[model samples]
Target: MIKQTIAATAIATASAAVSAAPLTLEVFNPGEAAIFPVASVLVKGQQDAVLIDAQFSRGEAQKLVQQIKASGKRLTTVYVSHGDPDFYFGLDVIKAAFPDAKIIATPGTIAAMEKKAAAKVAYWGPILKQHAPQSIVMPQALQGDTIKLEGESLKIEGLTGATPDRTFVWIPAIKAVAGGVVLFNGLHVWTADTQTVESRKQWLSTLDRIAALKPATVVPGHFAPGVAMTPDSIAYTADYLRKFETAISQSADSAALIAAMKTAYPAAGLESALAISAKVAKGEMKW
Candidate 1:
């Protein structure tokens, strides 16, 4: 009788632990209204939450603050997955709201942000105007590759990849992926930053790595409204990159390349991204 009681107790304890740490994901995307259709994911456990990426504008970050407050979970960490302005520019707002939440990012990401944050702010500050962040809030370098939430692990992948700064978070317990700048859906893929052919190839390789995980849920860092967060977005991004490469080779100038992409993706939003990417690819514009 004693042995049976001990076994039952252990089993019950294990089950309760599992139940307590079933991480749930809530995504916030400001659709097309904001400059970029960037996404911020709030990963929630029973009592704590970890936010992935702060949005681009102050207004959007304020919205995220409201969402987190509504979730009733204590915001423990804010992990900026990428160093881009769209990913971390709004950190000031988030940090102001949750002063105690740890703001962190990979060492590589921190390095990139440190290098470019000033220039990015200078460029977009006027355009964003009231929506711009009051000031940039840089994230501390995360020591390791995993963040713990309610005893569950949120693994940060791609540190060893070609671009260590551009990483994604993989939640193994829930079999979901919070794909950062490495993935896009329902919009023109941003190729301006990855101008070189080799860089684009490495990005495609990263997408393949995400697919290999076979995640049940995939949240893109940027996506159009109404687009489902699924593995299909991975396939869409890979295909768009290939088409973009082909257009780059065939077109004689940026205009031609832009025209080709528009013909291919007539309904796609974010023509600005396509235009700039084509210009950079064709050597007409220096990014």
Candidate 2:
């Protein structure tokens, strides 16, 4: 009787382990319509969900809130992957909707957000107008590199690298990546921020690190509509950066650089990004 009881307990434990649900991901982006096509991913477990980055405009964040409500999962945390305004400017809406959600980000990211949030708002306010956030909701500094959803771990990578502020999330259970500023897809890769050659090189290295992980799902922070969220985006971004570098060295002015990139990526969207990035790269405009 004792032997039979032990066998039953072991079998039950194995069954429970096999039946445990995996975390699922849902991504929301405003596509090319709203300024930047920033992606916000909702990582849902059995009972809880975690949001990665908030959208740029208040209206878009409201849309994201509707999606979360539709998911029927309680949101526990909202993790801002980068310090860019487009990533967290809509946090005000998110906070209002899920007031209990713990908004968090890497310490470096938090610092950057704090430093630039006001200036960014001043610059973009006129353009966004009605869709602009009435106020900013700052995220608390994340204590560690890991965020837990259910029993699974969402690891924040690239913290110790050259660009600690620019990090991505690695969800091991799902073998997925939520790439931040380091990755772009179906759009002209933003180079205005990483104007220095070394900075661009570090960005490339970050992409390679992500590629090494071989994630089944890869979500680019900024991508055009209909672009597949896959490893192919990584390749597209890296190649664009290389081409931009070549164009910068060959061209004498921002116009030439812009022409070169447009020729290289005729189908890519976000010409505004390419124009500004080319100007910054050619030293014709300060970003």
Candidate 3:
């Protein structure tokens, strides 16, 4: 009986080893000219892979599609974190490349997309001009809180604060977290939706939840190339939110607020995000 048990255990161990495939995480940063450094991470297994976010605009998405193809892995899934146009606008490009890949997002995210799809398209149309996608490709509603690939499964946690709805993906095997738009590494986060004090507080609470994950590596939605996506991404975002709130309270005018923030984060380009936040704060623009 003891010999039989030992033989069974060895067989199981061997099977597990054969099924385990090495996974690699790579970030594709769409550098300058992009309002922010939108990062798309490719979580590649030996046979298949998953993409974190589609990208912000036409050019970025085109570059990302090429990067994915270069990876030489079958793309099975593209998980969108939120309804934000930047994350999904380039989805069509990816779909064209991997015809079988399913774009999935939470129901709430889909709703938000439906709510803002037209508005976002109008907003970006003039900016992107001919580079814009002819039409948006909405994501299919994710069935559950996890994405199951062949030999691996990624846990998804729906979160709010950064946006009306955002999803974070946790990969246990790699001890990594794809934080979507909830975290920003070395970039000024979009505060247009959180102009009020209450909204900013909620944003802080959301950051706390992500921090609790203790991810060894974090893939922030917007991050500069070569920047390490560690737990510091969460800290940086939290600190920026607090500073933005303080700047709002202390600055005498919109220009003053923008100046103060720029002075604080000189290297953090993309003044467009700050302009949007200022417009929203002054009641000049919708939240």
Candidate 4:
């Protein structure tokens, strides 16, 4: 396990180092859905540090907080992979842990959160009641594809499939990527955001590009952390997506396609897989 690695364990030794950052991963509960391992990276510099995704729920976020409680370092930044409630709602629960932690989210995500505040009260307010979310802030709107925080550099790329407005972060240094959509594990990739045929084309092609990167580690919005993005993993994701396009081109009815694909998918949680596949494939949702 990486926990046993000298670099991974030496976090404590860098406690007093002149220049170093403290990084760690935290797991979050994905409600009734599969438990996704959400990573909360802590970058410690001097007497402060930053945290990534809190968790999916208040309870799970607390667990993350408890783990970092001993760090005794100040939490400085909080970057949300996207605007999904599943990723940032827990911020309310761990606000105290990072009293000054500024919530960093894309401008689109910030807008989404604002637009949904009224309709999705339960998802947003609960975080305040639960994690208290010290403050919700927008990312500086990092101009280029790459962004630098503290000293860590990140590449921001986006896709419009799972979520209408979502982007993933690529950390070159760690050879790791954090995608907002749950592309791995068992969750059927949500095609809810796809609204047009052309858009769907862009989405699929974009995912292919990310996979081609073949990251050493992948952290999607959901799913426990993946050690290495194997060719099988990337291929399966692409294949899963292509199946939808194929079913669409074939003009297969959603109902029948869903049933047939279900039998073929066999795997748990794939019922929606076929349905979503057909819907987006046919451009029913436009994208």
Candidate 5:
């Protein structure tokens, strides 16, 4: 039994000028259960904007499209943070709303997206029903690590977490990092695709690298609705991963691991990730 809160909370705020195209990030948190809270951000310039990571499900995507349109900013591009279904599945709605908006991703991300298309459709379609994307919308291969958006350079970098080739957008001007699956603020960290201890360690290293950049703000892949992504959010995530690693070593079995984890972090919302990770650890599940 998966319980959820699919509520959308909108946040409109401005940041200091990074360049002539000072960005105002408007985040929409669709508090959906089973599916974690997805942060769909509209990075608005003075006259245009770039969307980062489409939300999951058709209804969620449609709502996001409406919000972007309502902002009156000409959407120029949509950059998905990773290959995960939650990140890119709503591209259909985005394309429908902003036909001229170019969708872009890293070369590795593009390849991963192509590989996972079938599995995603099969797994998500039944659950999401009409809300799931009717077909895959692939992003164009990013020519270089950086893209110029309204005179500001948005740097695209790969950081592995939920999946390899996970992309993060760094705006040097504003010192803001648009973290994909690599960061989770006030949300359950997804571990279904992380299959090994080495991989988890690498993910931690990736997080550390992002932290070193010392962004004034970080927009995580999943976050509490309307709440700002702060440095504390990064700390919270780092602590959770450490605890999860320790719990894996101390627990006797999957059930014990989950029970202990629940007891240790009763307030954490996404229990599904715990269950899936535990099963994967015990060789009882496959990602």
Candidate 6:
């Protein structure tokens, strides 16, 4: 159930980025920026469509819009998933094409965007004025834990195990789960320099949350569309944290821990975890 996301997944891969019917998801790839957990598209009939995540750049965002138009879906709304700029910033370009679509994000995401917007207005204001056009609407409908939209009910809740903003959406009708950031498979478990110390233990328990759903298809936040949610996605990331933490706590140095881990999993994000390891070595990383 765990697919290899090597160069085999086709780097810089572009597959029209569109769906054929009831719904098809695609990988905007985004090249070096961030891979995996592309975008999630839901097409219900011709007049109803919803997208989760706009991807990183203006180009991918345009393609996503085209994909929706190609499906003849009326591009109703987009769920930001979280406030990571790579995930949400492209909403600016997206709105130019689909002017009426609204974004659905948690309170955290909304506040983050507003703060960023304010920062752009105050300090980076010139950059915002020159290149970043702010047109996408602020997220609404805190919707707390769940939201019923267009016959599709999305339950939004954070899994303490992943990042604090981690969210998962459950579609009971299809037995499908869109675990935004909580569970990631075949890609770096983290990209945004998350607070991973204590999140490690919580990450393990979060798997229990996804497992409780017993989903058939799991939609990861970064890469492609996924099925086989359970241990395939959750367990892998948890295992990494567990092993890394154990080794570090045992006074393993950064080089030793990274070498052992890299040998075990060629794709282990050792480069990504270097800063983390240094912190652990210095006792700077909290448990």
Sum up the clashes in candidate 4: 11
lDDT of 2 by residue, 186-265 (tens): 77888888989999999989999999999888888877655677789889999999999999999999999999999999
Weakest 10 consecutive residues of candidate 1 by summed lDDT: 1-10
Model 2: residues with Cα > 4 Å off, grouped in runs: 1-21
Task: Give TM-scores for every candidate, taking all chains together and pairing residue i with residue i.
Answer: 0.91, 0.91, 0.85, 0.68, 0.88, 0.73
Q: Give lDDT tens digits, candidate 3, residues 1-287.
A: 00011111121111001112356787776565465346677888887889888877777788788778887889999988878887888887888878899998888889989999999888878977876777889889888678876577788875333454767788877778888877776656678866679877877887787788777788777665445667889898999998988888888777888888888888774567777786677667776
Candidate ordering by lDDT (highest first): 1, 2, 5, 3, 6, 4
Judge candidate 2 at residue 284 and give its lDDT. Answer: 84
Off by over 4 Å in 5: 1-21, 33-36, 159-164, 225-227
Which of the two candidates, 2 or 4, achieves a greater TM-score against the reference?
2
Worst 10 residues of 4 by lDDT: 1-10
Candidate 4 regions exceeding 4 Å error are 1-49, 70-73, 122-150, 159-164, 224-232, 249-252, 270-287
- Which digits, one per residue and each the tens of the lDDT, describe model 5 over residues 1-287? 12233333322222122232377787765664325347777888888989888877788788788788888999999988788778888999899889999998877788888998788789778988988898789999877677777898888865334444876788887888888787875555677677688888877877787888898878777655544666666776788788878888888888987887788777665667778777777677776
Clashing pairs in 3: none
| Per-residue alpha-carbon lDDT of candidate 1 for residues 1-287, written as tens digits (9 for 90 to 100) | 00011111121101001122388888887664466657788899989999999988888788878888988999999999998888998899999999999999999999998999898888889988998888888888888789999899999999888899999999999888999888887778888889899999999999999999999888887666556778988999999999999999999999999999989888676677887888889898887
Residues 1-287, candidate 4, lDDT per residue (tens digit)? 00011112212211111122333333333333212334444444446555656665466677667766766766766676656555665676667566666666666777776776444445445534644344443344434455555576666677334443567666665556666553544434455555456766776676676777777655544332223333344555556566655655555566765655555455524244445546655556442
**Residues 1-287, model 6: lDDT tens digits:** 01124443433424334333333444334433333225444534335766776765455566666766766777777787766555665677777788788767877677767767555335433533443445545667455566555565666656233454566666665556666656565554452234456656666677677778787666555442222333366566667566666656664565675565565567533245344544554456652
Minimum summed lDDT over a 10-residue window in model 5 is located at 10-19
lDDT of 3 at 83: 80
The 0-to-1 C-alpha lDDT of every candidate, in the order given, reads: 0.82, 0.82, 0.73, 0.52, 0.74, 0.55
Over all chains combined, what TM-score does candidate 3 have? 0.85
- Candidate 1, residue 5: lDDT: 10
Clashes of 5: 2
Model 5 TM-score, 2 decimals: 0.88
